[model samples]
Target: MRERVNQDVILGALALLFGCFIALYWAPIDSDTGIAEKVRSRWSIGDALAPTVAGVVIATSGFFIALGGILRGTKSTLSAKNLTYLIFFLVIVFSGFLTMRYAGPIIAGALGEEYRVLRDERPWKYIGFILGGGGMIFGLMSLAEGRISLRRLILALLIAAALALIYDLPFEDLLLPPNGDV
Candidate 1:
């Protein structure tokens, strides 16, 4: 019998390498600020903080995944079904992102206003994020459950709204996706 390589091992190794690259090379080169900075006698997070932390987390997770697969002697391999699911996921995510990017502008234009101007305004600012984000959540949940439910739809919308509020409320300076671009 031909010995099949474990998919988890491969995926974990790739993730570990990618994460290490991000944490070591990409983040340092791309970011203007260090992971942490001292500004006016106070320590603060810098632009590199998020990517560096994410990289470390990815690397750590990958290492554990690889270890787990090795210890379990699992021979799991990718299947056509997995590929289909991945493609579906990508489609759903991209659709949501497209909606997030364009919905605000389209709606603003319909209202006889430029999105760039209204991107900072209330209700107007949240239109795209809420719709697109909610759609993404709903779609993902539906995919997972293999069916759609009114409860899921409502929960998705509420989650998106709550996320918008959480991000927008505390951080006055932050711009949601596509807002900065527009």
Candidate 2:
């Protein structure tokens, strides 16, 4: 029964990854802003695809690590709870990344260019942390059976904190004028 559930989790994660990739790559680039309207552009395909690639890689790695844990012993594997947490973390992480990418210019207009740049730089790091810490949590939960060490927990906490702090930093005001400017 648990094995079946684990299989489902793995399959679901894979499906989500594929969907995101399709949306990002194959989807039509907007006429005006280009894919820049979709997400932060690094002015190159590689940069644009980096986070998606990283997500797929980490999620794939977690799948293997989880399999290894189960094979070792069901006693040493991740529970449904752990998988839930992993999915939840990933959803928020990617959503935050997307929010910053598309909304950044408008936000920058209100805050300032510096804030925009800072905001632009954020999604990647958050993605990295989610992939890194989330992977570690899933792996350790699988191998240790809810026996994660304090240090591992702290690391994840730190990554979360870093992301939050970066997200909240205030930008200098640059509100748009009501009247059309020449």
Candidate 3:
């Protein structure tokens, strides 16, 4: 068990370190190619940019998660490690569309400026994010924190959906994700 924990921590950390270097070099592309740039005729993301950042983010998350597992040692009853892996994988897969749809408003908010995306909602996109993501998040939590039961799973899923709704609905009038329907 200890050996496994050490392996997971070390491997995850190495992956994250590699990804950090990749992102460090590539993350700047967005600023270089964004609307403010007059260097190119039009704004365009370099092909390497998105994947690099995503890799970095995933690696970073994986590191923390692995390290967390190491810290917890062996808690056999309900293990969410696999679930964590799945959620992280899904997030990395979706990060591109998620970033494009949500980063602007997030950045603007951080900068204390008003911003809006053309539409803050999209049917399929919203549905997938809410339902699919919610399930994963809740399922992970279920597996991690306590015993999993039908009632617990339902409750967790509901909580996840509600959390998404809270973020989506309250912000509709103010700021919505780029793909979020107005």
RMSD, every candidate, angstroms: 8.4, 15.7, 14.2
Each model's total of backbone clashes = 0, 0, 7
Give model 1's TM-score versus the native structure: 0.61
Q: What's the TM for model 3?
A: 0.31
**lDDT string, candidate 1, 1-182, tens digits:** 32388878888899999999999999989999989999999999999989999999999999988888777756667787999999999999999999999999998898898888888899988988999999999999999999999999999999999999999999999888878888
lDDT by residue for model 2 over 1-182, one digit each (tens)? 33445554555456656655544654333222333333454353433354555556655665665565456523326576898887866665565444434444445466655443453355422433344444445445444554657667666557655554554455323221111121
Model 3 lDDT per residue over 1-182, tens place: 44443555655677787777667654555444422333457655555667676877878887886777678654344246777877765664465345445554555567775444313434323443454454555556654665557776677557655766777766755432334432
Model 1 scores what on Cα lDDT?
Answer: 0.91
Instruction: Specify the poorest-scoring 10-residue window by lDDT in model 3.
Output: 116-125
Which ranking of candidates, highest TM-score first?
1, 3, 2
For candidate 2, the per-residue lDDT at 67 reads 60
Put the candidates in lDDT order, highest first. Answer: 1, 3, 2
The window of 10 residues in a row where model 2 has the poorest summed lDDT is: 173-182
Model 2 lDDT vs. the true structure? Answer: 0.48
